[model samples]
Target: MFDLNNFNQESASLIQELQKHVGEITAIRRFFHQHPELSRQEFKTADKIAALLESWNIKVTRNIGGTGLVGVITKGLSSKMIGIRADMDALPIDEATHKDYASVNQGVMHACGHDGHMAMLLLAAKYLSLEATFDGSIVLIFQPDEEDDAGARRMIEDGLFDKFPVDCVFGMHNYPNAPIGQVMISHGPQMAGTIGLEITVTGLGCHAAHAYNGIDSILVAAHIVVGLQTIVARNLPAQDAGVITIASIHAGKANNVIPQSVEMIGTIRYFDPKTAAIMEEKVKSVAQGIAAAFGASADVRLKHGYIATVNHTEQADFCIKTAQKLLKPEAICLTKKPSMGAEDFAFMLAAKPGCYLFIGNGPGDGGCTLHNPAFDFNDANILVGGAFWTQLTLDYLA
Candidate 1:
């Protein structure tokens, strides 16, 4: 076990104070969980965050882009600033955890642990506002619409970094599989870029009894799905990790007739832009080619969502070192493989040099995995996250 007594005095004291407030932090997390909101519509969440920040005398900004907000905490004239983001929106999955604080909103839940994320950042915000001993500034961002990948972009368009002028920014997410309290850090390609594709296969429709007279869109869609399965395997090289997932296909509704058109929708995940572009091109070409061979037409629409969350080397290393100062070295998982999932945090990293790291939710049982109907944010992990943020802020500002 790592000993906190070996750490610097400030670090130990901050961790001690943080651990003392576990119940309060967990209560705040449960409150957010009970009143969940969807992306770009976090009105109540934004208000609550603003109120909490205001209570601590952290300057609050409301409604920058949609329902997103920022809480600024400054101590001195130092130009250095740190940006810590916590997503406030919930997923569309229904709650299944059956906890006392399970989501009250129908068909919406904090399955991604945004509630814990908010609680951690809010804890840091409140603490720093009350007891910060740093010379620089910190911006606690309660971002919205992370599920939709529009929150970060919207916040940028609303002049977030421009308005605050931060030297670097950082973001945190909770991973369900890692042992709770473990921190995962990676420098490059921390997460994959995501592209959503919708391909509509069009063909002539006719009576099922006379199927030979008209083209079959359902058959064409099946071919497209099968053909798409090859782009990741055939087009991309072995070292280049990419995925082409065809999630949904909609076609005929009746048993007696062939459908006129079928829609195939899915996502493409990649780390490199060239590979993503190549995969997208192959998707359109193969889709159209197969559809045309079946006497059908394919209309493909590919919408680029979140970009790969690439981390800057210096910032990532700084984060790891900062985290190590507070916890045991083994508590930080530096070799954890980058996830193929995408994040809007990529946008902020694109504009600023920073790191986006993960806190472990731990796996195996109830409410651990993200976006699952049964997932709940682990309350115990809040101390780890809060301590890391608070110490990292004090260190960065120092």
Candidate 2:
């Protein structure tokens, strides 16, 4: 059995030490937030991360899978290895938060709290380097393109695991709904997989004055959009969760013109892989049938996005135990249901047995939901998150 008293004492001391660096962490997060970089184009972000990691005398690798992945490895006495990941990409949304640290980059923002993740992991690196708290090795992964492109998969494809074999991997995201300093975790199906779909309905364009002179692609798109809803409502099982949303529709630019074709783009989300496949098929069938009814034809394309973030039960339980030992029992909340959102960390989980959890960023008073313009990574959670990472590393490597 692990000694709770010793663990608590050590964790509390670490938390106190982390608090001292809160200002520095906040500064780092703000700098990244101000100069936000988009998906795969995180060149500046990657350079900054590399420079920091190397400053700690931690061995660092750059341009691993692409231009934006920084892999820092610490060799220790024990051979056991674990990996910790932090995404380094920002969203494409324009800054709406009118703070001094508001995004300096035009039409880009760190609305998802990735900047905080990076800072916390960097703090972990600094602490680990100073104390050598863990017996085994730790791989610090700062990945890029998590907002849209699958940088995790790219790293895996480029032999991330093969190069530095890790027995287990762990990831964390800052959740907005949960209260600050509270940690939430779950055993399985933490987040859903996503698919982005685009459908183009083609029809004969004719003068708007004539009634039946040509097929109406706009009407066909509208029917397709409505028909797409029945797929989740009728086909999917009641217990299984699935969603289909038509987010974008474009056809005619002018008031009176009946455009030649209408393009519709949407997203599909599901937890189960089988259900996801079924939903994709249903989407195509519905689009084709709706277009046929309108005397039109549709070309449907579905692009597979991120996979479901499913946590390994054993790893999750271990993480919960670790959290309980480190923080007050009330600080950890076990989630009752899985979130419908998708995470690129799913790719890392696919490669190894691991878990993904949430470190609370507190309620959004003025801060909006994730991806919202007013959202900012709460500075209050910095110490909480950094302490959690440090403790988890020690516990896992113990």
Model 1 CA lDDT for position 315: 95
Best by TM-score: 1
lDDT scores in order: 0.87, 0.84
Worst 10 residues of 1 by lDDT: 1-10
Off by more than 4 A, model 2: 1-10, 71-75
Candidate 1 lDDT tens digits, 101-165: 98899999998899999998887877888876899899888888888857898899999988988
Candidate 2 lDDT trough over 10 residues, lowest sum: 1-10
